[model samples]
Target: MTRSAPQFLCDPVLETVQVEHGFGTRGAVAPGGTLRPNQVHGNAVARFEGGSGVDPLEADALLSRIPTQSVAVVTADCVPVLVASADGGCVAAVHAGWRGLACGVIPAAIAALSEWGFTDLRAAIGPHARACCYEVDTPVLEALEGPFGPALAEAVRPTRPGHAGLDLQRLALEALSRGGIRSDHRGSAAAMCTVCHPELFDSFRRQGDQAGRMIHWVRPIRDA
Candidate 1:
């Protein structure tokens, strides 16, 4: 029954939300806009500053400085992270599935933005499978342990005392903390699990091939 807040990007200068959706697609919704989504089994991020047409920029994270430019990413069972500057008004969106988490995508994005001079950055982690239902195999557990660490292991404790479930959101929060993004300033993490809440989200793990995607978008809009 839970729902994610409709993520809207704003400059406070322009005052308009550029993109309407940020799900399962790869291309800008507007001219000066940019989007990238990938199926690769790792973490990566891209940045945009000016007008970028509808072209697929393959990456899991995106950042932008331009007012109307939109940087987008996609997800299914993964956590979709949306970040913004606490004082600078800049923003970035990321796709953080288990593999992406293992590859350090969220932290990498935070690090990249830090290089750009954003100190007090806020982040919001969107809907995805939780430790309550995201069970994994041995290889997945081992792989996740490398980047997610012992806490990640603990988060994925056995659901029924023998079977394990991975918490992608917890991994994301830990990644953000490791990346130096303060949690208090960060926004909300969608409580709805894509697998458990079939009515609201698209779950690759639970629904398999039948899951329909949801959008997580943010863009500065022009004032009327």
Candidate 2:
């Protein structure tokens, strides 16, 4: 009941309140003029309130309170996070990779939404590179230590010499928890992993820079 298309996904948490959203698969295109950020893999957030100006699209997260105007983020191997208020009055689309996670992009997006006076939030984390195929070295683990701290080991698995497989979804969920989104409000992870299911997803690790991105989107809707 949570999918809008055969390839696109939705979450019951957001669907319960009827927030318009879709987690893209491989070939879907985002609508024209959809608000998105430049995605620096940092914690910057951009806000939209039905404005005509397009300033500050340089953020990694895009939040909106306006109905109909879509907000989106693109991803291949990175996490695409969609968040909305309980009443569907506002929504956010975040692009989170490990660097963005270490920088607190998820938490930053939630904080920005809370600052806008909508704290009762719900979120859905889309597919990304899972631990099965996503390996990392010492530098990657070291960078993650600051954000994940003692909980870091919970999402890592030793693979090779000075390297390990990393689960980005777990860390993303942790970031969501730290951002104040209740445990139940953060929906379950998508079953597909970008690397493992190449037929359904685009994997940056598998296909390198030539991989096509998926456009994950969320649109604000009026509360009933």
Candidate 3:
């Protein structure tokens, strides 16, 4: 069966940079077999050093200084984050689901980009399950609040009697802030909830295993 091209959401902040980056919706086609990791909902980050062929390793984030190599991550309801240095020397793609976010994937990606001499980093948080529909039980709440403390806890509001809605965007911003990315360096989040907009995106929570995956990608522009 022929797959349709993915609908993409472009970040205006990232658009100002000398790089190509965007978040894909269902059916998006990634050029050049973009490097995608087998996200395990942990904080493991990998650095790509310009290689040939696709190597889908097990990791949640990917960083690269190679201008020709594009890096991406697949997600349904998970947050897809794209990062690039202000100078466009390096770029990174991260898949941060609630588990990955709680464990520190954003910080890990930032640290990796920092090691690549990318100090002034800019990031974009793509669409996912927002607080309006992302209700979680006590353990998930504890897992998020335990590591992030009150600020994150404050964002979690009771959705019902026992479940609370967690704001993944706020949590991701907190992690980015801790990693030294200021609000000015950040792009306005797409903010569309994947679960709420089934026509535009795929949601794992809504569609289960049958949900189609979206690919978010970034690449530095090589000088001719």
Give the number of the best model, judged by lDDT: 2
In the range 51-143, model 3's lDDT, one tens digit per residue, is: 553334778998878888889998898888999998887889999988998899999889878777788988999988887778888888878
List where candidate 1 sits over 4 angstroms from the true fold.
Answer: 1-34, 53-56, 159-163, 220-224
Candidate 2 lDDT tens digits, 1-224: 69445467788888987888888888876667788888788889998887574348698999888887789999999988999998898999999999999888888888888899988889999888887889999999999998899889999999989999998888988988887888899985553688988878888999998899998888888653
TM-score list, all predictions:
0.78, 0.93, 0.93
Quote model 2's TM-score.
0.93
Please report the candidate that would top TM-score against the real structure: 2
Error of 2 at 65 (Å): 0.4
lDDT of 1: 0.63
- lDDT scores of the candidates, listed in order: 0.63, 0.86, 0.84
